[model samples]
Target: MITVTIYTHQDDITLDQLKADLDSLQSTVEHQVVTIDIDTDETLRKEMHGSTPLIKVGPYTLRPPFNRQDLEVTLRSAQDRVKYYQDDAEYIKRVERGRRVSGADRFSYWFSKQYMLVLNALVLLFVGLPFLAPVMMKQGLTGPARVIYAVYSPLCHQLSFRSWFLFGEQAYYPRELAGIEGVISYEELTQAETIDLNAARRFVGNEMVGYKVAFCQRDIAIYGGIFLFGVIFALTGRKIPGLKWYLWVLFGLVPIGIDGSSQLPSLAKSFFPSWMIIRESTPLLRSVTGLLFGITTAWFMYPMIEETMLETRKILGQKMEVLKQTQKANR
Candidate 1:
């Protein structure tokens, strides 16, 4: 049977007349009527408001000022077309696909709307867990704390000299070569070889020096900066403009690159001549550059993601509206 769909607003007075016209043709055509209230949805209202009492007879649409003759002609044409194309594979597929809305579509619609919230929560959890490791160790929960450290070890260098410590006399223990004075240096305290990467990575603090965070100073700062801006972005209702590409390259990439690259000279000092000078970045510089990288990277990327998600929402929302109308008609 052919289906006749009518899209109408509450204030539409021609709806009764349109229905009566369709009812008059009941004996001539086998069809079902589905009336949808466009006023209920803003998007629907915007789309169908200008064409209230819009009638769809199969694939044919009849706009306002259409009379009984117009309805009859359209309906008869739709009936003849359906009769010829009923068994056509492409026609059948299109009809079936239009009527069916799957669970995955519903999920996509929901995720498209709530994606930012999900992202923020995930980043919070990711950035928060590393701090939790030190807290767990402070409370003597070494087993769970070690698990956190182990899980994060692959993601970060986790070197004691490059990590922040909780419940310690000093927040950070830099290498003596870092030129950070007024605190006990890693070389003086641990007596380990300054260039020994493995030894530095293996040293997790003791009672005198509290447990190190699972993430290194720079890594924590980076994720912390991301989480910080995420909160700010959400708080601002996500209307923030995206950072320009060149600005991101200048502010986000350059400082971090310089700070990180400058430190490499210190690592390769043995290969350099005795007169060559080597430099190492202090924790403060590392945190600053890392934070800049994180914030600017998010600033550059999140707004673009928001734009894509907005388009996804628009498309999915339209599909959902169609699905809603279809379900209402079926009932």
Candidate 2:
């Protein structure tokens, strides 16, 4: 059967005439008509502005100012094409190929409809890795433990001073510069001449200092917050509205920006004259900022991603349905 797509806006004057032309062609062509309102979608309006009330008769398209005569001609051509292909030897192969494509489309639509399930699984893996690395090391699984640490090294600093330890006395040991009086500092525990600041980033700790995870405290907070948000989203059925850009900037961008950027100027103070004064950040502030960025980023983007996934499902699902009906009719 021929498919007719009518593109129209609410204010389009020629839509009535176009509808009349289509209705007049019903006896002339075996076709299905689908009307799409371009008002709600600016992209559709821009695409069809010169061709308002654009009509599709099978593979043929007719712009505005066209009459029923044009549609009849187009539909006749479409019918002939179908008839020619129906008796062709290549038709079976073509149908089989089309069926395969339709199955792929259906799978694609199903994936889009349940994109959050994939997203949640990814988030779980991401957050779960840090804990796993520590567990592996504690159980004397040094091979996998080293591999995990090596893999995560490029992504994070993994500084022992700023990282949490799984099987340890204290969860965290901040740097001396971090200035927390109560908790043990990195310097007091390790007076080894073999250790330096750069090496600290690679240090995974031993039995005395406790085995550090593959990720640092801030990184842990970041992934943890993202995973936590993913869980909440799943629990809430992902009905949350998209986070506004302004709110994203205020919450997601600002706190992390301030906490991260503020430390830079302090570190660069030596590059300037003596008059330049700068400040340093503590581990607590880093974790807090990282956590805020992670949670807000997920909150801001997840719902917007859902909107895109929904649109994808709509398009692919429609195609899949059409393909299914076509295959059944052909059989």
Candidate 3:
């Protein structure tokens, strides 16, 4: 007997039509119809969306957008395929060999086994880009520098007053209005006519002022902290457990949230009452708070991700091992 299964959630538009078609085939092939509601199995839902209502006829399985003609043809082919393998010993061996996963599958399984290496590479790339932007500008390569700035702009405010500047008189150029004592303010340097916030952000610095990194001071601290923690976790073989949810909120989420969020309304000092003070954050405070936020957040997320990756590694490693054993036995 053949098994034709339909997989769907509650709201599938074409479920009934597909079901009717599968039912029509039951009499011809001695098949039983089974329905799988993938909503009940999230894993299955993710694995097979829009590719469900699978019709398994003998050795072959049919996916969606299939018609009555396609189903009939597939059933015939599947039956023929089964009979050919059963009757011919050489065909059976050839089919089995063909069924064995290819080198690409082996590579994927290998990758899943070494998922940490991939994770490390991604974190390094993310942190490395902002640092590279200033280097590109320092070399007078404005094109590459602009590209980097554009890439990071969405992720950061890129305000000249806030970001780190390499090869400059100081590490940063703050807004004169910020009131950090003794340091050359944004007004002291190239200076400003009116506060051109957008132009200030666009300025990556000339030779006199030094090149600005694509990210702000706080953002640099945040991503830098994350990269540092990622390295530490990898070196420890990723055995660490995830940070507790509450502590994650306390250490990872709160400080940065308070510092950053409080600064938002401060943008409109005119909007605030005369009695209420809108405090501008100094670069030192920004960096310190950002660092705390980043480390705690990475400590929270990366270990949990590592746990999932480790399970994936175990499953894929076992699959590869079984495949190797089967191949050896067949040889």
Candidate 4:
């Protein structure tokens, strides 16, 4: 039987209203609806101390305030999925555990694998490329390095002054750009009498030339750090302890909140930097974000491989079964 439990705060939405809605839909579904007032319920209060208006069902929790129609739709979809999986258990298990070892069961397996590889490569490219600027510039391979910088331009403004320059003044792109135009050189731009858009902005500098990441030192560190963590965790087969997928979703999003809300002028400035720095520095924060990206990349590849291998095993198992049946028939 399908069960829905809705938890709410004191004087929020009334139980009568919820009951009325459930009664209205009673004829449409074979389900039971229960409401738990979190303010009064000691056990629920302790369990859901920070989270109110939380929904708890078997193996799934839906937090409010969600659209009632959407919730209903999800319930219906879930019910159907449960029924289908239960009905097909025997065959599903048979397919899941393959009987034979075979090569590329389908053409799509190769495509999925390729897509996953490309995604992983992109992740590494973003994570490690910034660190390689010095190495590339030293080898006179600034052309390829500039291409990388150009690719990341939309994502990061690539501020020359803000970014930690790897090499001396010669390694800097904006300085070189300043020289080429002949209108302004590095020394003239840096020592300008007046601060104007036409003159070099300390962070962005000449917008007319050169490319860089849109963010400052802090942002690159965070994103690049997360990407590197993902690569390591993917290799190590590690996961965050005691965090379900739902919790991880919330935890992963806290960084965005910490980073964005810190900029709001209304809030106390002290709270801003405190939360922002902690949010950025926390190992839990970085690891989870990395795991999320890595898992998404891995899922795309793992499923296709498993499915193809399963199909191949089934085919070989069928052949063996057929041979046995033939021998029995002949005997």
Candidate 5:
């Protein structure tokens, strides 16, 4: 059956008159009428606000000041069009496809609306677990702590020298080449070979030196920055405009790139000539670059995702409304 949907305010007197008109044509036309109150239904308010007493018959729509003759003509046209296409296999398939709003569609709708919460929670989990590993180690929970460390090992370099330490004399231990004065360097304390990458990664530190966090200092800063921006975005009701792409590249990508790339030459000093400049970045420089990259990247990305999700929500919302009308008509 063709569906006739009426959109209007609850107080609009024209709604009764429009319904009476539909009823008058009952002898000649068979259609289900679904009335929606724009004031109470937020989706309809957004879509059809100020355009009420609106009438929809199949694909045709009529606005205010329309008379009974206009309604009849539109309804008859809708009926004829339905009859013309009712027997076509393609039309039937299209109608069936449109009517089938599956569980996936419902899930997509829900996710689109609640994605920020999920993202924030994920960032929190990603950033929080690394800190928890060290705390667990300090508390003698070696089994679970090792598990966290192993899980994160693939994601980060996790070099003890480059990672933060908790429950010890210092929060971090950088290589002597970092040129951080006063504090004991990683080589001075551990006596490990500076060139031994495997040893650095394997060393989780002792009680005297403090256990290392599952993530490197830079990684912790990056994810922490992402989480911080996520909170700020939520607090501001996500209305903040996205950072411009060029600005993001300059502030987010360039510093991190330079800090990371410049450090690589020091790592592969064997490959470069003796004349080439080599330097190790301090914990402060690593953290600053990581934080800038994380915050600005999120600032650039989240707003774009929000825009896409919003459009998805609107499309799915309209589809949901149509599905509800279809179900009502079937009942």
Candidate 6:
């Protein structure tokens, strides 16, 4: 006896055709073959819950769009196992030969892995750089650097309170720019104001230069974390112990989220100075990571290029072999 099965959730025209096909194959095969609708049998349906249209044929289940020849082959092989089919050994050998994976075929496997590195770099440049540039520059450049502000306007609110301003006329923050003093000329400075400034200079603490771009701590960590690791991965081919390993990257992301989220809600802020340090100094850190990203990307590219060269060499070698054979025959 030979059995094959297919499982599906429901029955319809497709199921009807499948059943009809199995009935037609009865004449060609020496065993009792029949199609059982799993949907019709409550017990079968429950037994295969969530997995439908179960095709059960002897020891193996028929998976779907059943190829008659493949089924016949399977059935024959099974029959041989029971001493029912005479040519079982030949059949087994044929199946084994078909399953063999050759050395040349491994090219695609290596190529797929390498391409992932390139994909990570592309995401960093297109999605990351534009979003992060303003945050990075807000503390370094002032006014007319409004260009960076304008560029980012579509993506974010660029709210005054959330933004950071840099040097010139008292690190002009956007909130101050919106107020009356925004357009004031230097000539309007009062002697009293200058006296007060000179007096207050000794007390001036380090000011917050850039408006906190609306992105809180976690946002920086996730985007920046992925960006950071991606860079190192690409540069070093994702081999670094501290950065490339998944656990360390996750560890690094924790502070990014903890610092950003905890402080944003006015909750307990435990991971501060470290958070601030990471946020402000990301460019340098990512620079190291970026080198890694580049390495990873190059690593991917190197193999693609090497394989193309290898393939060319293989073809050339084959041609040389053929030419040498011809020359020997001529001699």
Which is the leading candidate under TM-score? Answer: 5
RMSD of each: 4.6, 6.7, 13.1, 19.1, 3.4, 19.6
Error of 2 at 174 (Å): 0.8
Candidates ranked by TM-score: 5, 1, 2, 3, 4, 6
Candidate 6: where is the Cα deviation over 4 Å? 1-111, 129-160, 163-221, 241-250, 264-331
Q: For each candidate, what TM-score against the reference?
A: 0.76, 0.71, 0.67, 0.35, 0.82, 0.28
Best by lDDT: 5
For residues 196-289, what per-residue lDDT tens digits would candidate 6 score against the true structure? 3222211111233323333322233334545555555557643443324354334443443443343232212243544442222222232344
- Per-residue lDDT value at 265 in model 1: 66
What lDDT score is found at residue 242 in candidate 1? 98
The clash count of every prediction, one per candidate, is 0, 0, 0, 7, 0, 38
Per-residue CA lDDT of model 3 for 20-68, tens digit only, reads 7666866665555556666664445666776766655545777877798
Our tally of clashes for model 1 stands at 0
Instruction: Count clashing pairs, candidate 6.
Output: 38
Write down the lDDT of every candidate, Cα atoms only.
0.83, 0.75, 0.74, 0.48, 0.86, 0.43
**Compared with the true structure, what per-residue lDDT tens digits does model 1 show for residues 1-331?**
6778788888888888888889999999967787778776555677777888898776799998789999899989998998899899999998787667678877877886778788889988998898998899888999999999889989998888889998988898888888887999988888766568887777778878988888988887888888888888878877899999999999999999998887776777877787766887888899999999999999998999888876676656655665676677678
On TM-score, who's better, 2 or 4?
Answer: 2
Instruction: Give per-residue lDDT, candidate 3, residue 61.
Output: 73
Candidate 2 lDDT over 31-106, as tens digits, reads 7666667665544555677678777655687786777788788778987887888878787576555445555676
Name the runs in model 2 displaced over 4 angstroms.
4-27, 32-100, 192-195, 265-269, 272-280, 329-331
What is candidate 3's local distance difference test score? 0.74
